[model samples]
Structures are given as C-alpha cells and as structure tokens.
Target: MAPTESQHFGVNMSSLEFARSVFGEEEDIGRSLTRGSIPGDMESVTLDSSTPWRLKDLELPPEPIMPLLIEAYFSRFHWYILLFHEPSFWNKTYKVYCQPTWRRRDLSDVVTVLIVAALGLQSVLQDSTWHGHNTFRIHHINHRQLLLDLVSEVRFHLIDLLANPRIEAVQVCTLLSCFYMFHSSPGLAWSTSGMAVRAAYALALHTKAPASQDRIAAQIRYRCWNHITVGDSFVTMIYGRPASVDAAFADLHELEHTDDLTIPPVLLDLTGFSECGDITSKVTFHQMKFRLYYIIRQALNRFRLLRPSQPNTNDDLVAISQEIKDVEASLAQWCQELPSLYNFEDWSLADRWAQLEYSLQNRPADIQEHAEVILLQAAMIQLLYDGAVILTHRPLLKYQVKPMRFSGSVIDSMQKSLDAVIGAALRISSFPVHKFEKHFVVSIVFHYLFMAGVILCIIPTSQPLTNTAQEAKAGVVRIIHASRAMAQHNRISRQTDKLLTELLKIAVQRETLAALDNTSVTGYHGDEAEPPLLDSEMSTTKDVPLEGPKELLQANTTTIYQPDLHREFSMDLPELLQSYHHTLDTGAARNELSDQSLLPSALLPLDPHSVFVSEQLDDIFGSLQSFYS
Candidate 1:
C-alpha cells in the first residue's frame, strides 16, 4: 500500500520506461549541464527559424533547451519521488499541496531561471578577467567569434522571454542584467551593463524577493571590483602607482543599500572559487591562475619604481632586483603550467589565460621611433578600412558580412574574436612602454590598427545607440584620435585626411553609380547620346522644319524674339535678376530714379521655343518678317 522509495524521490518509472522504449537504440547521452548522464529521448534539439513560435522540429520550449533536458531527466529518474516528497514540502510550507499543473510549472520555472542565471554568471566572470586586446591585430580571432555567438543566442532567449512576461520573468530579467557586462564592444560594456544591473535590481524589488534583491545588488557591487582591478592595474602600470584605491572602492557602496547583510565576497581568485558551485569550478580555478600573472607584474612595476634611472645600485638595489627576477621566474613557470588545470575546451576560461600570457610575454617597446612605426601602421590600416567603407558604402563589411558570416554563428563569433582582441589591446595599452617587447608592440599596434578599421566602420551605425549627439561625436572623435595615434609616421604628413577625403569622394561616386544603375539613368554617364546638331547654312529643306521659331516670329518683329535666352534657361531667374539688377543700381537709385535704374513698364517674356532653334529657323523667320513688312 505504501509508495516505493523511488516514488518518494519523484522518480517516474513509467516515464523512464517510455523514454527507453522510444530512443533506446541511440547512444547514451553523456554529461550535459542539464541532463547529467541521463538518457534523452531525442537525438538533438534544433531551433528552427522558419516558424512563428521562433522554433520548430522541437516539441519543447526553445530557449531553455538545457532546462528541458533536465526536466526530462527529473521526470525519468525521480518523478514518483517528486510526486510524493515535493507535495509534502509544499503542504508544510504553504498549508496546501501544490496541484499537478502548479507543480509542473514550478519545476519548469525554476529550471528556466537557473539556466538563465548561469549564463549571466558566466558573462560576469568572463568580463572581469578581460585585459583589453593588444596581442593580435583584432581581438583574439577565435574567442571573439565564440563570444558573439554566445551573446546572440542568449539575447534571442532574453528578448523572447522579456516580451512575454510570466511569474518566472524576474529571474530571467535578473540574469539578463549579468549578460550586458560581458559586451566589451566599444561603449556597450558600460551602458548596457549598467542598465541590465539596474533592471535586475528593479525586478528583484518588484517580485518581493528580498534575498534575491540583496544577492543581485551584491553582484552589482561585486562588479566594482572589476573597475577597481582595472584602476589599480592601470594606475600602477601606466602612472607608477594607484592614485586612490579608496576612491575607487567608494563606487561599490552606491550599488547596494546600506541595510543589506548579504554582500558578495571580494572576487580575488581564491574567494571566487569558494563561492561558486562545482559546475563553475573550472571558471573559478582559472580566474585564480589568471590573477597570478598580475603579482609578477606588480613586482616588476615596483622594481622599476625603485630604480627609475636604472642606476648602478648598492647591495639593497641588487637584492630587490634579485627578488624581481624570482617573481619573473615564477610567472614564467605558472604561465607554462596553468593551462592544463581546467577544461581548456571551455573558451570562457581558456581565453583569459591565453591573453594574459600573450601580453606578459610579447609586448612592444616604448621608444619614440617604435611608437612612430606603430602609429604609421595604425594610420595605414585605418585609411585602407575607411577607404573600403567609403568606396563600398557599407560599414563593417569584412568583419560582419563576408568573413565572419562565412561562419555559422555570425554575431556570436564576431563578438568573441572582438572581445579577446579588445581585452589584449586594453591590457597592453595600460602597461608601461619600456616593459613591452618590440615585437609585441608591433603586433598589438598592427592588431589595433586592423580593429580600428572594423571599429570605425561600425561607429557610424553604432552612433545612434548612444545617449547624446555629444557621445556620438566623442566616439567618432576617439576613432579619429586612434587613427592619429596609431599612424605615428604619417601624423605630420596630412596624408591621412587626404586619404579620408578621397574615400569620401569614392563613397559618393559609388552611391551615384548605384542610383544610376537602379533608375537606368544615362545622363550621368559619358556614353549618353548627344543631342542632334542645328541645321547648317545653305542646307536644303531648312525652311520645312522651322515651325517653332516661325510661329514666334509672326507675333513680334519689334522685340525680334531676341528673348533673354540665358534668362529663359535660368532655373532661379527671378532671384538672380533681383540680385543682378540690385547690384547694377548700387546706391544711385535709392531714393530717386536714374537712367540705369529706370524700369520698363512691361517687358517681353522669353520663349524658349524662339530662343533655341536650328540655323534654318533664322532664314525662315527673316522671310516671314519680309512678308509681314
């Protein structure tokens, strides 16, 4: 009479039997983030784009495929147990057991919420580790594509769910806030991330989930650490020491309410791992390793500070130099060994370490000569890219259209490559020039120059997304500045602007050609037909074809049909005459009429038919006048 132990655990034997009967011939479903070794009834879940519901060929919710997989796993293994135990838990908490519909929907909602949350969490972690791309010309190529793919996929779900609100919408919304932080494209990381975080906080407050609200707020506060890390590293690396760590940390308080007790822990490598679950241990552990390189960097910085002039030092200076050498040795060892620790296949973690090592090992010199060369490289690339856009009249063609689109995930792949390169650039840019390797500088500068092309092309389209015209202008100006900065050798030549202007002309020409091609206009083309010439003197049958001029000559011989011919051809004749006559009169006829200023009472209107005619029309008109006389 009593239910089995499996029944209490919500393991549905019937469902498992049904799944096995249906899809037993297929291979066993391996480790899925959702299924966890459970066998699946379907071979794969495909998002069919042709359907109105946004997906076809799949009999489940489209966005949360992973969640559906988990749902199936739960139904297969523990449905009977969940059917009994979960009801008891519900009855104890709410004084009534949840109905079957309510229970089913609740599981779906929780699973959806968790999957979405994981995506956001992943984005946040990935972003914090970014160092600004400088190693390759365009952010790390492969990584950028991956990131873009991920964002696009996440966004599709975000848009769909947000457009249709449900009780589970709050968590979906919360997770979306975390997604924006990872968009490292130009200005998006700041604006979109800030909005997402705020939206998450609002959703938490509206849902009356104080704990979720606190947690979300804390996550937002934790983001301040990214800014802090960047600030500390930037200040120390560029200017020799942090201007104010206290001032930087002050931003964290604003992200949270004064009364919230659950604060997100400081996300320095070690604490980050302890807070995260096993599913994300790979992410956590690598971040710890990623942070290790900075320790060596800081020591190297300190050594430079102590010996600014690289002076021949006493025993103390020698001792400090030895310590710096030891740190470098440790860094080199760690860089070589750290890659094997985590699942290197997960691009989210591997990318950060790869970028850090690239920066530390391969950066450029700070000498004026090399900087100039870097500048020239940047200039040349920018000119070429801009020229392409101006000539072709489409922006970001290479990155977005032909090259990246050749890949399956267009936006996602583009974003990943962009992210890696951007992170490297930012990191290398922040470091002191002297510390950078010559090849690294050349390589990074070359990459930025290439990226600068992509960026400049995208900026025109991206400008409208900014809050103000000033911001748009600022962004454009920044690109211009970057072009100038990167193209050092040509900075003084004025060739850059000349190149830009020529590209503008080419762009205009392209547009004109397109319009002509569409409309079939031949007037702009040199090959267009020329108008027939007027009749020659003494030509036969000349009088037979002069109908228009003969008709005009019959009306007026006194006026002679001289007809202001130029005036007849003029488009803005009235305005032109007004200006012309006004100029001729000058100030002589201001108050009194003079001979030159005297106006005719009635002037003859020019007839274009009479003004323009074949030479035969003149002889015909003369004969007509003689007959009239």
Candidate 2:
C-alpha cells in the first residue's frame, strides 16, 4: 500500500475504522470494536425470538427525563464506581434517545441506556420530591412500574449474554452486580459479579488496555476492568472467596479522568461543593479505592494462612506474625502518604465523626446542602482504611476468642485486633443517620458497617461495658435505625436491618447474663455503674431468637466473659492501634503504642548510597573534631 492508515496515523488501525478511532466513534461502537474488529459474539441474538426485550415495546421514560436521569447517575454513582466513559456515554445515549422514535440502534447500547436511566430514576426518586411529578402521570406511565419493567427486560437479555458474552455484557453485568448487592436480588449479586469477572477475562481485558491508537478506548478498558476486578476484590474481602484477578491489579494505571463523571451544575448548586472536582478529582477517588483493595487483598492472604477455623499449632500462628506486621506496615504507610484531605489520623475518630455530623446539622451560609459527593467520598475512603485495619488484625481476635494462652506477642496482636475492629465499628455506627442518601447506600459503606456492626455486638459481651462500650451499643442501635430507613429502598437492606437488630439483642442479653444479679444491659460493673439504655424491647433479653452463632451467643465462652476484668474502652483510633498491651490476668489487655507505632518507622528500605554517604560524613566530622581537639 502507498500509505497504510496505520502508517498515516502512526498507530495500528482496522481498515473499516478509517480515520475514526475510538475517540471519533460513539461509546457503543468503541465498546464493540475494542478488539479492533466487529466481534460476532457482541451481536445480541434473541433469547426468545417471540418476545425479545425490544426497545419499541418497553415504556421508556419521557424524553425530557432522560437527561435528568443521566445527570443524576453521573453525580451520585459514577465516581463511586468508574464504569463509563462520560463524554462517550452522553454521545451514545443522546444518539439513541434524543431522536423521535429512534431509527437505528444496537440492543446492547439500548440496554445500557435503559439501565442507566433506571438507576438515575431511582436516584432522583430518593428526594421524595419526584414521586408525583406530573410528567410521569401525564404520560400514563407509573414510575415504579417503569423501573420494574426496565429490570425485567435487562434480565431477559442478560440470559442471552450469559451464554454469548461481549464487552457491553461486562458493563451490564457489573452494574447489575451492584444493583443486586444492595437492591433487589442480593442473594444472587455475588454470583452475578463472578459472571462479570469471567466475562472480562473472556475479552482479555486483564492483559492490557485494548486500544493503541485512541486514548478514550484505553481509558474505557482500564475502567471496565477496574470495576470487574475491584468488585471481585470486594466480594473476596467480605466473603473470603478467592480473587479472580488479584494479579492483574499490579499492571493497572490509575483510573483515567472521564467527562461522564463531571458533576452537573444543578448538583453542584445543590451539594454546595462547586470546587469538588478540583479538590479531589473523581480519578483520585477510584485510584484510592483501587490501591486500598490491593492491600485488603494482601491482608486476606495472610489471614488465610492462619486459617482461623483450623490452626495447626501455636507455632503456626507465630510464624505469620511478621507477615501481619508487614501488611499493617503497608496500610500505615498508605494512610501516611494519602493526600491530607483524605488523611484523618490526627483527630480522634469519634470526634471527627461528631464534627462531620455537626457540619450536616449546621452548615455555613455558603454551603448548606447535605450529602456532598466529595465529602462522602472522604468518609467512604476513611471507612475503607478502617475496614482494612480490621481485616489485617481480625485473625488474632479469632484465636483469642477461643481462650487459648500463647506468647505475649499473640496477646498483643489480639488486643490490637480487638481495639481496631471495635473502634472502627464505633466510628462506623457513629456516622449520623442524616448523612448519605437514604434510598441509596453505597455497597462499600454498608459492607464495612456490617463488618464493624458484628464486631461491636460480639466483642463487648466478653469484655465489660465501659461508657465507650455503652455508646458503641447505642451506635449499633443507630445502625439498626439507619438500616430500617435504607430498607425501604431495597429488599436486602430490610433483611440487614432485621439481622443487625437481632444481633444487638443477643449481644445485650449475653452481657446482661454475664453481669448477673446486677442485671443491666449496659452496666460495666466498675466504679459508678453505667445505667442500661435503649429500646424497651431490650429490657428483657431472654427468649430472644437464638439466631446468632451458638459458640458466640449461647455458650459462656471466654468471648462471653465472666466480667472479672474491666478494661475501659477509652482511646483514640491511633491509640487503639498501638502495639503494646498492659498485661492482664485474663490475657486480654489493650495499651496504646504511644512509644512507637504498630508499624515500623520506615515504609521502604533505606537506599544503600544514602546510608553509605551519611556514614562517610559522620567519619569525616569525627576526624575533624578530633584534629581540633
């Protein structure tokens, strides 16, 4: 050829693409052609030819509402999970729905548009102002009914995609996975997410970004794979399933900026944080989450080696102590290196959460609106860090719960685990019920809440209830209250509410039983005994459902202590993470690592050259001093 298109552009190109790289093409086109050819599997064939999930038959929302929905999706959810190319998404969605009766379309593209609009509609409805908007009634379309229909149709096509997957299939699968986790079918969410991960592998997305000629396609591939692996990683963190793409994360570039995530002017005015994009770019949020997941995965790896269910011996437990220190050291450095805006170690977590709640209650004249995205991102990242701390230290707690005596190091590790996990829970439950969207709870936020909630409920039964412990119990109640409010939005949250309430009742009853004769749900049996508080239903703890674990709630296990020791739960988060403990007769005492941090002083190895030069300088200085003398 006189001059190939690849030669002209100085990048490889498919013949049909001509001068149009992924940048020039629409999002839908770019998605299908990421592999540089029209993939046959990308074709959306009929799962049932008789009644396909056809766009014409579905009751799409009024055209005016589409833009509003898309904007809501971007402002509220996009930054949390970087799933789309913002500019390209707008181009593709507008091309499909903006026209009257839409002449041409891809079913996959149409499904994407529909799902985004559905989630957007859900977000908009959260305000309670949109429930009876005239547009929906005037069109004779019920908003709730319309939402159900969109979901049903997606399920129809998802069945086909399950057998014959494509790039867009990965997108839908990821979104649907999230939807199920908190929304409708939480039981299936994990399995659906697993499907999304394998689908990404089918496309070889883990290997590398697919587009060499266009930056947009590269960004999309990176983002697409990020959601898949991160979603998988989160599931692994919570569920302890093996990570499917744990190794692939090492090669990933930080999530690229996308126009789709830009907060709309309406939301900017509403949230009162106009400078959010600049303060903590959405790109930074994703990268922060990505790196956090890597460390969490590493912690899980070390925890697995101990096998809480079946440890070989005390020596086996001792073997991984150094490895635990290394992972925690990594987390400590991760926190230290974080941009100051996200770093929150200086203040007490309880005080910090109270300050956040105060801001929500009484904002300055300039910024009064609630649930700002940037602020919420900071809270979520903090929770992620706290959750990582728990994951790192929980194995020791598990062994300690069993009542076996071991070395001082094991006891130190156990106390660290106990305080970190419980402190994190108190911080989590302390998050004001008013903050964050009522209808939409981010999965990560709720997941950590659940983790912390469990720790708060069970840990205090074994230990005496301090004022801190009582407040923590109240915090768990608030969690129950928050879960109830969230339950109205999704089925699983309702179940979560029921589960947490039951767990709280059991924890209190166990505490009450252990306290005996004193007979107080919250009494610590120390100087000036604290009074019992919260629900009248909890005044009587016996005959409550034995839904919790037998080993935990039923038995007078060491975890359900006899109340001989009364270690007051009074310390900041940094204090709780301290390495040393004030030894107790029962082998469970917590002390602040005040002298030295839990982690080593340095994160990375000292450079040999720097060390040698410093030594050389010391020698020269010594010689000079001696000569002068």
> What local distance difference test score does each model get?
0.29, 0.56
Residue 557 in candidate 1 has what lDDT? 27
**Deviation in Å, model 1, residue 138 alpha carbon:** 30
lDDT of 1 by residue, 1-629 (tens): 01111121224344443454467626432323222113442312222122223221212223333333233222221111111122222233222112222332233243343333234223222232323222212433333343444445545455444332332343333333323322233133333333333332322221222344445434333433323333233323322233333231222222222221211232212222232333222222323322442442445344444532233223332344345345545554544544322322222244443343344343333222222332232232222222221211111112111101122232233233333333332322222222212211222233333333223322212111122211222332333344444353322113333333332222222222222222222223456674553353212122222222322334322221111211211222234334334533442111111121111111234233432222332322222223223
Give per-residue lDDT, candidate 1, residue 338. 43
Pairs of residues at least 3 apart in sequence or in different chains that clash in candidate 2:
86-260, 578-593
Q: Model 2: residues >4 Å from true position, as ranges?
A: 1-53, 97-105, 159-166, 246-251, 258-280, 305-311, 344-371, 400-403, 442-444, 484-493, 517-629
lDDT of candidate 2 at residue 178, scale 0 to 100: 75
Q: Candidate 2 local accuracy as lDDT?
A: 0.56
lDDT of 2 by residue, 1-629 (tens): 11121332225455435535645656345454443333333343343233433463566666776677677777667757777887888887557555444322355677777777777766666566653356666777767777778777787767656554556778888887777776677668888887887777656566545345377777787788767766777877655567666462334556665654443444344322342334324566677778887787767666666543353455655655666788888988877667644443432345653554465565452233223555566667887787787777665454432233356675466556667777777878766435566335454466667667766766535542344445556667667677777777645456657766655655554444333312221233456654553354343333332132222323322232211221222222223323112222221221111111111111123233321112222321221123223
